[model samples]
Target: MHRRHFLLGGAAVMLLPVPAVADAAPRATLYKNPQCSCCEGYADYLRRNGFAVEVKPTNDLAEISRKAGVPEDLEGCHTTFIGRYVIDGHVPIDVVRKLLAEKPAIAGITLPGMPAGSPGMVGDKTEKFVIYAVTKDGKAPSVYATV
Candidate 1:
C-alpha cells in the first residue's frame, strides 16, 4: 500500500473504540482540618471512586470555608473543590461526581455536621441527615440529598 494510504489505515484503526478503561476520572482537592478523622474517610471514599485526591490540612477551617464560599449553615467537617463547585461534609462520592457532570446552577452540596452513616461517619447508630444545595450568595439551601 502507498505510504499515505497506509498512514490513513493506521489512523482509522487508532480511532476505533478500545475496551473501556477501568479507571479514567479527574481528581479533586479536599480541604479539612488536620485533626478530623472522618474527613480522611471521606477522602478514601473519593479515592475508591477513581478520584485522585489532594488532602489539604488546615487548622483554621472556618477561614478556608469562608474563602471557598461554603455557607455557614451548610458547614461540615470537610470541604472539597471539583471544578467550580464546593462539596462539604460527608457527601457521597457519587453525588459529587453527579454534580460535576451535570454542572448545575447551584453553588455546591453539603451534608452538614458529622451526621452518622455518611460516607465518613459510617457506623451502626447512624443519624438521618439532609444534604443541602447552597447558592453563591449564602442563601437558604434547598434539599439536594436526604438520608
Candidate 2:
C-alpha cells in the first residue's frame, strides 16, 4: 500500500507543468534598409528558429553598422544585435545558434556581402561563404566560420 501511494505521488509530481526559463532564447534586433525584402525574409527565418526578432527599417544601414562596431569591409545588407553580439547579413541560422552557444569575446559576426542562397538572399550557392568575427575596436575581422 505504501509503494502504491509513493508511485501515485511521483506521478502527480511528474504531471506538474514546468516553468518557462526566462532567458531561453535571446532577442534579436535587426536594422535593415526600408526597401529591402530580403532582410524581412531573414527576420522571418529568425522567428522560425525560436528567436524573438525585432526588425527596424532604416535608410542609413552603413551608419548603423559602423556604430554597432561592425568592421567596414565585413558589413552586410543588414545588421543585428543579440545580447552584446552583432549579427551581420544573412548568416546561416545554425551558425548563429553556434555563436550564441559559444559566446565568443568579439564585437560580432558577419556574413559579408549578401551571398546567394543564404538565409534570406535567393540564389544558388555556387561556392562556400565565409563568416568573419569583428573585434570590439572595429579593426580587422577574422574568419569565424564557413558555410
Candidate 3:
C-alpha cells in the first residue's frame, strides 16, 4: 500500500492509500570505453526492456573482455555481466534472457563488433548477425543464434 494526500480546498485535505506496483527488472552490469557513446545507448535499450543496468565507463575494456574469456578477434564494443554470464557487444535483451533461462555451460555469448542496427549502434542491418558462444576452455566460438 502507498500513502497519498488529496487537497479538496485551500483548507481541506484527504488521505488515501494507493496500490503499490511491483516492477522486477533484471540486473546487469556493463563495462565500456569511457568515450564510447554507443554503449550508453545500449544501456538505455536494456533499461527500456525492463533491465536494471549499471554502466561503467573504463579505458581498460579490452583487458576486462580478455579476462572475461572473450577472444580478442570476436570482441564487441562493450561487455556486460548478467547473472553468471558475460554478454558482448550490442546483443538484444531477448537473447540475453534466453541465455539466462537456458543456463548454458559457456563463458558467455558475443555478437562481435558493433553491428549495424543491432541494439545501440546506428544504420540499417546489412546482413543477419551470428551470435557466438564463447567457452572458458579456449575452444573456437560456435554459432549460438542468428538475428
Give the deviation of candidate 1 from the true structure as CA RMSD: 3.7
Q: Alpha-carbon error at 145 in model 3, in Å?
A: 0.4
Model 3 C-alpha lDDT per residue in residues 1-147, reported as the tens digit of each score: 123333344235334444444236678999999989999999999988888899999999999998888999999999999888999999987888889999999999999999998899999989999898998898889998998
Q: What is the TM-score of candidate 3?
A: 0.83
**What's the lDDT of the predicted structure labeled candidate 3?**
0.89
- Give a tens-digit lDDT track for model 1, residues 60-134: 788766676677766999888877888888887667777888888987888878877778776764555677888
What is the lDDT, from 0 to 100, of the residue 97 in candidate 2? 88
Error of 1 at 108 (Å): 0.6
Off by over 4 Å in 3: 1-23
Between prediction 1 and prediction 2, which has the larger lDDT?
Answer: 2
Q: For residue 101, what is the lDDT in candidate 2?
A: 89
lDDT of each: 0.80, 0.88, 0.89
lDDT of 1 at 12: 100
Question: What TM-score against the true fold does each predicted structure earn?
Answer: 0.80, 0.82, 0.83
Give candidate 2 regions above 4 Å deviation.
Answer: 1-23
